[model samples]
Each structure stands twice: as C-alpha cells, then as structure tokens.
Target: MQTIHINRAEEMYDHPPIALAVGFFDGIHLGHLTVISKMIEVAEVNKLKKAVMTFDPHPSVVLNPEKKRTDYLTPLNEKRRIFEKLGVDYLFIVPFTSKFAAMSEKDFIRDYLTDNHVKEVIAGFDFTYGKYGKGNMLKLAEDRDGFNVTTVSKKALNDEKVSTTEIRRMLMDGEVEEANAQLGRPYKISGLVVQGEKRGRTIGFPTANVMPDEDYVMPKLGVYAVTLKQLSTGETFKGVCNIGYKPTFHDPSKSAVSIEVHIFDFHDSIYGERVEVFWHEFLRPEQKFSGIDALIAQINQDKVKAEQILRDMEL
Candidate 1:
C-alpha cells in the first residue's frame, strides 16, 4: 500500500474516486475492521479505490498535550503493514498539528475530502473530526450530498462494545490471552534491541533489551510467554519477556519502564537491530526477590513455565 502524508495529499497523483475509512485506528482492532471492511465492500461494488485516512501522533497528543498519556495499540509502521494485509490500496497519514487542528469543518471537508477525490467516506457511527472534534458523521452526512457516507455501528464481543481503549486496559492488566481473543492476533510490541547493564548475562540467562517507540503502549509489568521475530530475517523464536522497572534492582529515581526478553536457544548480539515481540500469555507478575540467587532461581522456574506454555501454544 502507498503511504501519503496529509500535507502532500494535494500533490498526490489523481486516482479514481476513493472509498475511504477515516479514524485514528490505533489498534486496527475488530471495531475498526468493521469500517475498513465496509469501505472495501463499497469500493469493490462501485469500482472505487479502497483507502484509509488516519492521523499521526494521535489527535489527543496534539489537542491536549499536557494531559496526554502514553497508550497506543499500533504505531504507524505496524498500522501500515496491517492495512496492507487488509488489502487497502492507499493509506494517508495526516499530521495532527495545531494548525491542522484549527481548520474549520468545511475546510477539512474541502481540503481533505473533496479535494482529495474522496467520493465515499465510511467511519464508525461515533466518529468525530474537525476542530475540537466538533464534526460528527451525522453532521458530515447532513452537510454533503455528492459524497456517499456510511456509518458503521460499534462491533462487539460477548455483546459488549470492543474498543481500543478497552483492549489497552486489558493489556495493562496483563490479560494477554483475553486481549488476543479480542484483537484476533497476539498483542505485539516492536522495538530496537539496545545495550543493557548485562545483569541477565551474569545470571546465565542472557537477554535482549528492547526499547520500543514512544507511542507504543506497554503491557503490565510481568513475565510473559512471547514469540520474538527478527525483522531482517523474519525468524521467529519462542521467548520469555519481562516488562517492568526490575524491582529486584529497583531505583526510586528511575521512572522509565524496560522490556527484556530471553529468546530460547539463541545467543547472538542484536544490539541496534529491530525485533518484534508478540505476547502470547501472561506468566506471572513481576516481583523482587531477596537476592540474586533467589531471583535466578525464580527466573529459571519462569523459563520452564514459559517453555511449556509455548509448546502448548504451538503457534
């Protein structure tokens, strides 16, 4: 799929009218999939181009900078890959800046929608846009006639609305399996392997420390059975991950969270290389032990449990 920045949409090569789905699509969860599927259906039926229009850095980060918090299900790169897999022909990533946020509703429609050759717009029924999110699907439909508008109702699981916020909450609570059931895929965190203090190496369980992008949401601080994938080689490895401040070596002054993974039967330095870890099951909560010996013993036991879980998963 071709990715076009919001500011460059005007300069894009003209294509046939597009059936577009617009949203933040943080996770591209089942709820968002409903709209995308609808867009594809409409595009196929009308022979229009299938496209997706999404915002970057999230509107919340721009509109309420001070109050914003870290929580994103899928970053831009991951979202792009997922959209491609879903068969979208084009993906527009709009820069969510203060200037763009100040645009009037008509200007947004004229500049982003009408001028961009968007003939049909599909979104969730509760979708909002324009300055301060004053524009709603109903209002957009009422204001325009030339463009077709479709509003999809919320998709639900177990008769309850399935939303990215809910999914984030589940991950934060360390409900990996439940979250995966709702997401239709394991919860994944991608990052670059970076140098660590080599504490795990000294204990015989060498690990790869990954620092994820700022926008990525982290799961609860705990040990998890995970599947690690090397981006360059597309190699998959079963692993155990720990996401926390390492209470065993806790420092009150350090406010950052760290994610460390120990890949089974792998021992190659991967510093600076990118890796993706998919959480399959929550093994146990992160806890500090009395000393290094106890911690090592606990980790060994955790590894056994993790390996068994992976064997059972067989994914």
Candidate 2:
C-alpha cells in the first residue's frame, strides 16, 4: 500500500478518482472495518482506487491541550499495518493541527474531499469532521458536490455497539477478552525492549523489559496472557506479561509503570529489539508480594495459566 502524508490541501491524483474511507480509525475495530469494507466494495465496483483518509495526534489532543491524559488504540504505524492488512491501496495521513482543525465544513469538502477527487466517500454514522465537528455523515451525503456518500451504521455484537471508547474501557478494566471481542482481534502493544534492573533473572524467570509506545492505551495494571512477536525476526512466543510498577520490589510512589514479559522457554539477547505484545487474557491483578519467593511462586502460577489460555486461543 502507498502511504501519502498530506498536511495541506492538494490533489495527489486526478485521473481515475478514488473511493475514500475517512476517520481517525483508532482501533480499526468492527465499525471502522465496516466503513472500510464498504469503501473497498465501492471502489471495486466503480473502478476507483481504494483509499483511506486518517488523521494523526487525534482531534481531541489538538482541541483540548489542557487535558493531561490522551491515549490511542493504534498509533500511526500500527494503524498502517491494520490498513494494509485490510487491502487498502492508498493511505492518506492528514496531520491534525490547529489550522487544519479550523477548516470549516464547506472548505473541508472543497479542499480535502473534492480536491483529492474522492468520488465516493464512506464514513461511520457517528463520524464528524470540520471545525468543532460541524461536518457529519449527513452533511457528507447532502453536500452539493457530486460525491457519493455511504454511511455505515453501528456495528453491534450481542446487541452492544462496538466502539473504540468501549474497547479502551475494557482494557482499562483488565478485560482483555472482552476488548478483543469488540476489536475482532487481540489488543496489541508495540515497543522496544529496553534495559531494566534484571531482577527477574535473579528469580529464575528472566523477562524482556519493554518500553511501550507512549501514545497507545495501556491496559490496567495486571498480569496477562500474551503472545510476544519479535518484529525483526518475526518469531512469536507464548508469554506472560506484567503491566505495572514492581510493587513487590519497590514503593509504587517512587516507581514508574513498566511492561515486563517472560516468554516461555526462550533465551536470547532481545534488548534493543522491537516487539509486538498481543494481549490474550487477563490472568490477575498486579500484587504486592510479601517477598521474592512469593513473587516467583505467583509468576510460576501465572505462566501455567497463561500457557493454558494461549493454548485454548490457538493463536
């Protein structure tokens, strides 16, 4: 897939036009997938390129600078991976800035939609764009421009709507299974393995200390069954991950949250290597063990439980 980064209004191609799916697509969850799938179908039928117009930094961060916390389900690189997996032909990343945010509805249509020769636009029912979110699927459909619009309604599972917010809530609650159900895949965290205190080695369970990407949403502080895949080697391993301050070893007030993964039966120098951690199941909440022996015993139990869960998942 071709990725085009656009910070201003300009036409990249004009000959055949394109079918565009526009959204932040944080998780690229089921609802967002529906819009993209429809857009692909429209593109196929009309013989236009399949394209996606997504934004970076998120609109909330640009609009509300005073907020202390803002997290994403999938950062740009991860989002690109998801989009490429879905067979997108072109990916247009629009940098979200104050100036871009101030563009009015009509101007946005004229500059972005029409200028790019987006003959067909697909968006979710609740997707909004333009200054203060004045542009919506309805406006896209009613625009005087000769563009066809398709609005995908809520995608539901078991009568509940699938959404990024709900998925994030599930992760924050340590409901990895529930979040995966909404996401249609496991929730993933990607980062580089960094040097740590190497305290796990003393306990007979060496771990790769991951410094996760700051922009992604972090799951609740707990132990989880996860699949660890080294990005460079493409080797995957079953693992147990802990996401929290090492309460057993240090005072929480003085320590920062950390991600440490113990890959079963693996031994290698993975420090400085990038890896993707896919959360499969929530095993237990992070605890303040009484001593090193207690922590080691609990970790052993966590490994057993994680192995069983990963086996059942068959991934």
Q: lDDT for each of the candidates?
A: 0.87, 0.89
For model 2, state the Cα shift of residue 105 in Å: 1.2
Off by over 4 Å in 1: none
Q: 1-315, model 1: which lDDT tens digit per residue?
A: 888876754764466689999998888888898899999999999999999999887787777888674567898888998999999999988888888888888888888788788889999998887888899999999876468899999888898788888888899999888888788789888889999989999999999999996468889889999999899888889989999989889872575788999999898888988989999999999888899999999999999999998996654
**Cα lDDT for residue 270, candidate 1:** 86
> How does candidate 2 fare on TM-score?
0.95
214-247 per-residue lDDT for model 2 (tens digits): 5889999999999999999898899999999989
Q: Candidate 2 — worst ten consecutive residues by lDDT sum?
A: 7-16
What TM-score does prediction 1 earn?
Answer: 0.92
The clash numbers for all candidates, in the given order, read 0, 0
Summing lDDT over every window of 10 consecutive residues in candidate 1, give the lowest-scoring window. Answer: 6-15
List where candidate 2 sits over 4 angstroms from the true fold.
Answer: 11-16, 66-69
